[model samples]
Target: MFEFSLRQVALCGQQPWEEPGELAEPPSDLAAVIGTNGDQFRDSFTRLCLYLARTYDDAPQTRTDDTVVIGTEYGNTEALTRLQLGALADGKMLSAKHFPNATSSSASAFVNIGIGATGRNLTLNAGLLTPVIAIWQALYALAADRSSTSKVLVGDVYSAEALLDAKREANGLRCRSGLTHATFVKGREFRADFDFTADHEAVVTLGAQIGSDKSIDRNGAFVTADFLDVIQKLDVGEQSVLTCRGPLARRGALTVTRQNFDTVGNGGLGE
Candidate 1:
């Protein structure tokens, strides 16, 4: 019922570090810039928030009163890996570390670290629809008069091995490890449609067409058809529609970016 548009989007990936490539040194004060790392998910998650905070800091379009909603499907994996290897020594860990080279400071606070105290919220296991869901959540809140202004943050992180394993195990398919983010703002219009086939397969449309122009831009190769099919498998008897106007949702529709692994879905891509 609420309409919205994406304001900004920032995404990160572990594959760049996994494979050989030139890299930039992050500020030594990364701990200060972004909150200290808790684990892979938290660190990568923090980086996402940090990038948005820094990039949009002085933008006239963004405000201190904006709201935030974070969506992720990798929360379980993040929590699981953190518990399994949070304190393990170098060789004992599953892969290369992506956080700061120092210990975390318990005294540190995330109170306005990036997006500020704009009533940020989080949603886990939000599926591929996370980014949009986050935007919708913020807009819905505003429409209900729950908040004066809203800004949304949505991101996801994955482990190389575990990501591929889950994909294969789920449906004998393969996937890669990557993280994504999307920030949204209030918009002027919205639309949606849904129906069921005679055979009862649910079909739905979020917008009249995919917004390839207004989406977060990225480079990579992925299976578009597979993703479309995956989305339709929402449930046995449910269908929904969603549509939006504005620069964010009307341009490039949300896409799968950062294809850091192979299509085999097997463990051949990375360690």
Candidate 2:
């Protein structure tokens, strides 16, 4: 019923993956750690936006009137990694520029920047229900008739620079590289070239979880994405379950549910 996109690290040469849409190109200095926390943060967002642009073919003209919803377990750890120097800098633990982006909403800021959108911004605490809650809330905003075209950017980001042993003593778990996931949802209109046939079903459910955030991709002809804290991949038959933990890189899960009717046209997306 839904499609998924994911990014993560691996213990064995990493898992084989392909960024189906615009994310095929790798990020600048992504493999190498350079620049300030805000720079890295912006870079991460830029990479995601480039991928989204390519996948959805969005132009710079995309306005902010739409909405961007983002989530993260930790934010702007890079900025927090700044070293305190001299008596004046001793107390300033985090960078000022990166301070605004220090929350879970940073990803949404990147989405708006990449698409050149002037839309509503919504950020929330990290938990199992965060992304799903965001999806539902975005839908509600539209159902409540706030806007005609709404875009939901759901994902997470963490501080890579904050991984140092010394900083671990200072900030604890805040600096670890967390997961990043996002997708676009439109109101009342489906994109083109999307066809569902018997071949489209998936079986094994791919999963990613951290803190309260989680995502699962169910496989087979009948498939759906479950954004729950504990998403156990369903086995070949119903009830049977298999599980695998994902890496600490950019991760995402997406799904597209469709419905068809033989009669005058009344139906729901079959799960």
Candidate 3:
């Protein structure tokens, strides 16, 4: 048996300097994450990941055998919007090299290369379930390696400036770096509905409860007892405290505040 007590986790992101209620930064990691839209997407993501790994996860290193998973609904929208803006400005096709950095997988790839991490790497864009699923998947990998240490980095990056004009048509999760909101709701579902104005970014660090017995899929849609691997059918708005038991085990609970049952398995309390 893996005799270890996994506790404490930290999250860092580009949130407003004033509204950080439960978050803290000694020197200003948040400041370093903010920049000219796409220019800082990978920077913010990596810095936040490094900070969380250092502050919360027990195993800390620039490069490790630990696996890394990333999630974001709209990543590098700034790069896309910028390419559009540049084309409009010059009336020409945007350079191909410019948009590759805009791909949703960019951040995770950059982090993997920067840290020289040679373990499993994953990225997702399944809306709200993205973060939850990434965390669950990371837990699965870590649980399987009880003797070794591991951590998960679940975050989001959205260019607030780019979304400002699109907010009216922009359906969900307006303008934010996406670190904090991802952290707050990744594990625990937020019951209240809220709206973001603009020029905001957030980052969230996700950690597993010490002894949860539930096994959650990558998208956090279906959950099961880790030991039995039996899928537990859930209903909309049905809340439950959760636990996990497996190779990567934990004990904790997050209430299922809501579930968006899309045919694509896009299910969760907050999606």
Candidate 4:
């Protein structure tokens, strides 16, 4: 089990789409924050990244050493589809602007650029389990490099286009479209433990320990939102956990404890 401090959390729920088969409008101030004339961030995915990145940038305690890990199941689906359709129809590439957003990692790249983070950056596409997996990656990074000052920024975004794609592919699975961000620091405000198991016993055991009152189950596409709610409601010295079951017989569990800093030391894990 790896552990870290969840210092802050930010989230943006599904934005209104005026029409079907079109990307949602970006936040009004997004262009100003990114220093653009509303041209660079045409796609919803990049806009969402910038919006969340601005949260970290605007924070008073923003750190220079930062790692970014973003997860998405259907990344920039509208741009990718447009690219594919353009290629198939005319045998010509789509607009150069759309080319960069076609890849899954482009959103994360934009986030790194938006926040000016120079440390390690990664993107993952693990379907419904993406958020939990991303958190696990962040915890692992912190645990592996104890002396590193880098704080991990982990997040996931699902656009309306992604939801439409899910409907087309998954026989209307009713996926939610939203974005969430959480920052994990070196000090201990929460302790997250990861588990990879084929059976559900681990989740059951951890669930019992955390209890139904304090635990939240990963029942939908965006469990991070629920996890954030629990964190916000938690009092100092309160503990909670989030559990999920992933594909290929995999399970994950994250235990969070709101530490009372008055009594607890700043050292985490091995220290």
Candidate 5:
């Protein structure tokens, strides 16, 4: 069991998703770019971090000790073995060789732009959120054991080539191409709350409901923008149940809520 609270949430991304015909395809060099391809990844990743900074005014600092990072890392080639690729992805931050050049590089910008730094940096990566949470729980417990205070930062980045790569696979599993970064810090101010638990039943029921109705929510919700509005409606004490695939072919659930904040008046918020 693990729990926390979030007083602030910020998000940024390309909007309206220009029509396919409206945009030119990525260059061939960028096709199937891996995280190990330092230059390409850093350029894209830096732009993402910049967008986050503009939206939240909180740029990423080069902290390698006190922060825990969790995310997905798909490989650049189909020949990459699942075990090998997973290992490669998981070990991204450790290999200085994969880091972009210090001169005229995005990674350099990311390192130089941030003002806050900490000492507990750690990186944990996974293909999905469940494992990310599980890893966070374990690592967080270890941090507590050591009597250390740390924050958890989660992020994910995907490219069009990665999505196309998946479509060519036999399983044809779903894929998303985007960048996401979230910050988690410990505090008791502003009266916020969050909860996560395993609930297999809710996962199945929700999947059925979505499938049968052919919609995620009653408002025919689809796309990231549409979903963002749904999230805004969440209020203190109102729980949001989430389901995800766990390790070794298992199912898991997580429940989230805002506690101690009033959402009844003042436009879905409490004081």
Candidate 6:
């Protein structure tokens, strides 16, 4: 079992077709760190990342060694779609700025750069299971190095265009345009575990143990966001667990317990 601590959590949900004018401008410090004028990208995915990254930077608990992990179903598809359409229309490439943003990892890369984290950085895609899996990977990275005190920023983002494409491609399956972020540090108060099994019974048994009242069934794109909500509501000495079952029969479980800060050692919960 891997144990960790929750340092901070931030979530942003964009209304369908939300206008760029309504979005908040990125802070000057954040814009400087990200090397953007805060109006360079009109895509919801990058804008959401900048918003969350600003929150992370403003938090006092943030560390320089913190690792960044992002998961997405469809990443910056708007940039790619626009690139394709522009090229097809005139047989000429679109603006060079959109080229780098076309990749799935671009948003996370922006976060990593903005935050100045030198630790492991990764971006994962696992359909609906992306967020939970990203959380699992973050915990594992912390566990891999016991002396490391860095927190992990695990996040997920889906652009408006990506959500639209997902809805149309998945037989009208429900999809949301939003982003979620949570920072975790290694600790002895929480347990993070993962399992791989094709049997539905295994997931049911684990899910039941985690407690149905606290359990969040994999329903939509906001699984991680919902989990973060539960984590933030936990009181000191209280604990809660959430389990997610992936399409490939992979199960990830996270149990978070808010412990008294006085009880924590000077090393900051790495014990």
Which structure among the candidates has the greatest lDDT?
A: 4
lDDT of 6 by residue, 1-271 (tens): 6777666565555344543222343334544544445344435566556556656534434546666777665655655666577678998766676645666567666666666666777777765456567777788778887324343333334445554454454332334345666666766645555654454564333221233653222223345656656655666778676665544455665566665442332221110
Number of the top TM-score candidate: 4
| lDDT, residue 104, model 1 | 27
TM-scores for every candidate against the unseen true structure: 0.48, 0.45, 0.47, 0.72, 0.50, 0.70
CA lDDT scores, all candidates in order:
0.37, 0.34, 0.40, 0.55, 0.34, 0.54
Determine the C-alpha RMSD for candidate 6 after optimal superposition of all C-alphas: 6.3
Ranking by TM-score: 4, 6, 5, 1, 3, 2
lDDT (Cα, tens digit) per residue for candidate 2, span 111-210: 5665666666666543323444455545554555554434544332323442333243321212212233333333222211121122222342223333
Report the C-alpha lDDT of model 1 over 55-117, residue by residue, as the tens digit.
533443443655545444443343445535655744455443533222221001232334454
* Candidate number with the higher TM-score (2 or 3): 3
Give lDDT tens digits, candidate 5, residues 96-181. Answer: 55433322233323423342434433333333433235335533543364313233322333344444543453432223333333
Pitting candidate 1 against candidate 6, the one with the higher lDDT is: 6
How many backbone clashes does every candidate have? 16, 24, 27, 0, 10, 0
Residue 193, model 5, lDDT: 22
Q: What is the C-alpha RMSD of each candidate to the true structure, in Å?
A: 13.5, 12.4, 14.4, 6.4, 9.7, 6.3
Superposed Cα deviation of residue 171, candidate 4 (Å): 8.5
**Candidate 1: misplaced stretches above 4 Å?**
13-32, 35-41, 57-64, 86-114, 170-180, 187-199, 202-271
Q: Which digits, one per residue and each the tens of the lDDT, describe model 3 over residues 1-271?
A: 1111223333333344423122233235444533234443343444454444443433335556756666554544555566567678998875666544656566666555655567777776544344335555555565566313334455444345524543544223223333421111122211222111221224321222213442222212223112111112334564344332111122223233334333322212221
Of the candidates numbered 3 and 5, which has the greater lDDT value? Answer: 3
RMSD of 1: 13.5
